[model samples]
Target: MAYPWKSWDRALFSQVAGRHWPGAEPVLPRLSRAADHGRLWGAVAAGMAVVGGPEARRAALRGAGSLALASLTVNTVGKGAFRRARPLLEAVPVIRRLRRQPVTSSFPSGHSASAAAFATGAALESAGWGALLAPVAASVAFSRVYTGVHYPSDVLVGCALGVGAAFAVRAVLPPAPGVPRPGPAVPVPELPGGRGLHVVVNAASGPPPLLSPPAARIAAALPLAEVSECTEDDDLAEQLEKAASLAAGQRGALGVCGGDGTVRLAAAVALRHGLPLAVFPGGTRNHFAADLGLRGVEDTAAAVLERRGARVDVAGTTALDGGARGAAEPFLNTFSIGSYPDLVRVRERWSRRVGAWPASVLAAVHVLRTCRPVDIEINGRPRSVWLLFAGNCRYSSVGLAPVRRRDLADGRLDVRIVDGGPYARTRLLGAALTGVLTRSPVYEAAEVRRLRVRVPGEGVHLACDGEVAPAPRELLLDKVPDGLVVYRGRR
Candidate 1:
């Protein structure tokens, strides 16, 4: 007999299909987001402080415990009671990323629910990670919807469920932690603790001489560091990668002697291997070294050997070749996507014999006479221009070197875009002589985590730091907080 409610039951069942995982799990994205939102938790805690009175504060102590328990109940208890199929029953790309088939009703996204509940709960207790939870939760939900894995309404309900769980627990439990027990705020870092040692020196990273007499100037201070010369031109990066791998693999700290680009490469390898990286600024500019208060190679070396340095955040670019523009890999340092990269390559190639001045003078004249404007878009808004530079660290040229301010550790990339013009061209040339480039209405300034430069044509030359790559419009510069540890000193 054909049941009148057959279609209705099928629709309902589809909404609650597969969404559960059994047995041991390493870590869920929702759970990780809940625990590690870091700074985002700050704002959430601030907002929470208002409504919950003294009694409320005391009750909120078990925030993490409650979040975990509530999540357990929602999936284990509530899910079975209302089994429904997921939106992915229809097939979609986004849902394919999910860990398992959601068995319970898909009305509420479990990932979204768990993420929201945990985020709010953690914010109520811990000072870090709470703030970013909401956005992370939202993204998870959006991905579900975008991929046709779940309905928008399900995500909404899931969010509400998480919020409700947080408040319920907050109203009942006692204050967990981070209430700032009356008195001055004690700095965790200043407290007594041991620090790890680190050193970096990329022997093969080009431009920075790792085997010359001056190289001794860097090695003298870090006599204890593992040293290798660029005998076969493996490049500074390959050298540091080896050194960093050895140190990290050994579970020991490291020290280095090299330029900013070398430092960045070593640091990346170190970070990947769970080791710290130190810098000697072996290359010209040494932009990051200056920003980290390294002063110069000699002093920087002394500090690493002496144990006066501390950890500082790092900034980097991924794919800048010795040519200009973008390519398959990323680069470290400022990227030039117009005439600027070519100018650097022209200078770098010639500096082999004549030194920087002659190369600079030649590139300056070439750019001043030629070089046309190129189109650009800042923060998704389209605009046209010629010269563009994105800097991981701020630096202005001082004679033979570039100088950066000390104590500026904000994790943001600095950017400059100059329109292709004769007067502007003149300024670009002057900057090559002097590494300072400022942005204003005449010159555009942008600070961002991710951005893309689209060239109407193909194969634009990309110059990074001092190296160059060719790909035209495709370029991505990433900011790595605590990217590299530079040796700091009293000076």
Candidate 2:
């Protein structure tokens, strides 16, 4: 009972099975057996959890989800749609016959589908880890044909189905930036009539106050809440500190309306006073506020009154020399060294003419053309690095737009280093433009609990949460777990 395509399928299967040399014979069987019933996927997940960072673990989970989908498709639709029988054992060596032959139709190999789906899904999240797993996936798929259980066509079609399933999942739930997922929401005692709320508005920080009018909007939303406004002449840090002190003395929640830098300062003060912090998105990008699901002052006020919120991690840096006085400086977003500060300065200069996003593009071009790598010592090892970025929490380096962390409580820093050597500038620029910076050999990413960096001399410009500061030659960076509680709506 040979089907119309049976001859061609068997010919291909015979070629694959017949070419098995002594070198691969033993290893192929072991690999095939290990991958049985999706065990290989579980192994991959465990390995990633052990060796990979938070993002790697997430990617592995996503891969598992895709594998599940692909398995469902192959077993249900693919098997029933084409009821092809398994390859004849006569053409296969006796030792190569799979001990446990699949009972379902052989038009598609379910094992191959799962393997491809897992690999493709993982690659989409983090290319470095994906590349590491590609060879294993290939071996698993080839084993199906080599074992004489599935025809070559079956394995090929199954692989396609797996890849398709991975893409489908990505479309439905795209990879998130910052924290890939938000932290769990916890209910706080409601603030009756905004009794325990105090807000500070930075008039000079973000866009012109006239367009957004943060103070007026916040007052309208929470009339009972006290608001402090920072004028052009006032020191924003001094004003923020005063507001934080007032809130702390009154045992109230501290709210700050400003850019990421302003929010970061407020967060530090709030942490010191052990008061919950509310963010109003007054910045150009509002990266921190957006990550908290706060769209505007109105949403922030509502969340505060309702007493719904989550605790998030904060990143802090200290001078390695132990010379700088006071507590470690806190940053709510990213901190970078090397050419990044120069790029930011250029972007700011051009932003007035072309706007923020457009200016960034032009600024990158200018910086790449003129910038040179800086020599620094990371963990006592000398290396020339173009840029070193440390994110408060894990961030996705993939995709066109910048990615944030999904879980703020993961308590790990996402550190990325762009290798600086021969043609380093060109390679870095190409990687950034192509959105393959994480995948490029010239770039390296890791999830670390702490990082120590030392420069040869003093007066190094460091960028923290979009604000530049002249820092000393040595620096120590780490995350402060549960550093601040932020208002967030329940999911």
Using TM-score as the measure, which candidate wins?
2
Residues 1-491, candidate 2, lDDT per residue (tens digit)? Answer: 35677778778877876675767778887788888889988988989988886579879988998999999999889999888878787878878767887778988899899999999999888788789888999999988888888888888999999999998788645665442344556555466766767888888777676664888889888888888898789887787778778877778788899989889888888888888898989988888887887767888888887887888898998886655643689998899888888888898888888888899889888987887788899888998888888888877544222446677778898888887899877776687655566678878888899998888855568889998888667888988887788897444
Segments in model 2 whose C-alpha atoms lie over 4 Å from true places: 1-189, 209-212, 322-326, 399-401, 432-436
* Cα misplacement distance, residue 61 of candidate 1 (Å): 63
Residue-wise lDDT of candidate 1 within 1-491, one digit each (tens)? 23354465456434433334332122333333333322223334455556654333432334444556556766776666665566544534332334454455765566556656766776666544455455665655555554344566666766777777776675444233221111111111110111333344455444644355445665455554455555445565666666666666656555555565455456566666665445666665565555555556676556555555454444544433334644233344566677677677777778778776687888767765776766655445665566677665443321112223323345656666666555665665466434354432346665676666555565667665566666534445566654444345454
How does model 1 score by TM-score? 0.49
Clashes per model (N, Cα, C within 3 A): 70, 11
TM-score per candidate, chains pooled: 0.49, 0.63
- Worst ten in a row by lDDT for model 1: 185-194
